[model samples]
Target: MSYMNLIKEKDYLKILIAGVINRFGDSIDAIAMTWLVYSVSQNASLTALNFGINFVPTVLIQPFAGAYVEKLNHKKILVFMDLLRGVVVFLIALLTYFQCIEGWMIIVATFLLSTAEAFRMPANNALTPVIVKKENFNEAISLQSSMFRLSELIGTGVAGIIIGLCGVHVAIAIDALSFFFSGSIILMVKAKSYLRIEHQNKIFTDFKKGIKYLFHTKCLMRICLIGTIVNALLVPINSLETVLCIEVYHMGAELLSLMGIFSTIGSIVGAFIYPYLAKRYTERQFIVSFLLTMSLFYFICILNKVFLNLIFLFYIHLIISYFSLGAGAAVLSTYSSVNLLDKVDESFLARVSAVCVSLCTAAVPLCSFLVSFLSTFINVSDVFIVIAILSLLLAVLYSIISKKRWLE
Candidate 1:
């Protein structure tokens, strides 16, 4: 079935709509949160620390969450986590408005928000297959990606104006509202959830089994390994956008918003093209393209430095460069996600998917730390070039190593 037919399913459509609303809010928050951190600390490292904190729960909690999710109603997990995060975020916004927010509090907010995300991921990974047929996974995921990108584009484009006029608190409040809306919508979707399992093992035992299965599965392990490196390379650049705008561009929320819009436009283009590309090529081909294009995105970071000397050239280069970055990110993520969902059995998809994600995201925090450390010695844009070179080498290295019995 085509993407349109996939959308005709009422339950899937609800999930899709909820996702769009949720992502729109998240896109705004991405800018708001990062800018708030940089504004408060005026230090690149701390800003990077805030970014890294978002993933700490992934490493420490997701495997356990995955196993726990396997025995519960995934729908309930999704709804509950959403509502919990909505409250936590709203508290942060209120604290900000009342002028009692501290740097540590912001870190805590990120951690709490991400902890909820940690639970949400496993539940979601396990839940999607129940809603859509296996064959439609690609179409369904791609459609969501495209929708997410469009929402991100609009939200980001608006965030600059919102933050400029209303302040970060208002933007944060919008995100909180989005979470409540998303939770409510997901609650209405009817789906078969595995609420209980006979003789279910203890959570730790199930977590161990998921890790063991991941270690034993060559393809899954490879996927995780590749994802880990790709994510690591991407994070430094992604995490430092705030620093780049404030320090390099000497611009504020408005410029960050512009960058976000163009970058998300790239993501939209990538998602739209994925189905066509999938039809013509193999998974390895997609990964190969992702590798090169991601490196290109970084190399363009170096180019942006030159254009900074000329204001006019900088804006032109930024739109083109960030667009490339966003597109490459979308393609890799959509394909990898579909492949991950396709490879696992529903019996313990949450556990398997959680372990996969934990492995994949393992290095993200370290990369953020690296960004902080390296920024002390070199220019942030220099870090971008170094990453570009690293990504290119990684692509070449993986291409040679995976020539056979690999992603083909």
Candidate 2:
């Protein structure tokens, strides 16, 4: 039952293998799905809608997902989710192969996949502490994250060839296979039983209790709010990035892929350095300082686009922006248990995670909608400026309010 021993090299290797398998498959869609949607509809609006529909489920289901995880078996839930995701993605691959993959099918499939993802995420997040030594938790999270980014680097290149030769169907088939690969690895890793706490009350009552606890805990609320505001304000920037690059800067996917590479590099570096940084500063301080640094960088990126050639400055700006994001995220994951982690019973972990997921993702669609609407009137630079301002404001406010409880 002791979680500490799981930090051993052998155990970490097991988790690393699982992550690699999961991320390799998950990376197939970095470019394929977006291209597929556009190919089907040729409408940017529909493409945005397709992306937004996925978040809708996250907004609605995350809290419950977290709660359910706490009350159920985390491993079994992960197994089932992986199995379901594999099936759903396989069907999509079949549709694509038949040349009958419609826009609605993509939307519906995205929603279903996201819904399953919502359930899987909380268990995965909370399960780390159970399997990894508490001290190695940050490293595990960073390693896992880097594995995902690494997979993207490899998968994007691989997807390019697959899409160019065999088309999106084959790429999607690889994605489905990746899921099964990940699931098999997960099934092989032995860990202590992750049973949910038995609650005698009704489901609704239990749900309310988890929600109330999340809001009532000052420290946890602060952490959740920080995550929520950051995602809400920044989601639009990510959603609109491709358009900004193409329409505003006259760039292409190649440059965007380079940005992704730099971002992943920064993440790998940050993962190595953040643990050292954490020993010296509180998580709240790190978040605020990094948030401010990145917000300013984003502003510069937006403004730089106005006077310079897109080719010259675009890569630089993207590198800085993504580096900042990667470093910030690395630090953030280290303190994943801040407020609600130890306070909740094992049974409520899923629900709590779901609520957190809902808050974190709820505004993604709204942000995407705003970007779609705003682009009609304003330039992409204006959109970036707006997001930068929002991030700076939230960062400053969170820092001031959470100073006393920075490390709590």
List runs of model 2 lying over 4 Å from the truth: 1-12, 157-166, 196-200, 300-314, 337-347, 376-379, 395-408
Q: What does candidate 2 score on TM?
A: 0.85
lDDT of all predictions: 0.86, 0.69
Clash totals in order: 0, 17
In order of appearance, the predictions have TM-scores of: 0.95, 0.85
Residue by residue across 156-241, what tens digits does model 2's lDDT show?
A: 54655677778888888888888887777777667763764545565577679878877876666666766765666556545655
Q: What range of 10 consecutive residues in model 2 has the weakest lDDT sum?
A: 1-10
| Model 1 RMSD, rounded to 1 decimal | 1.7
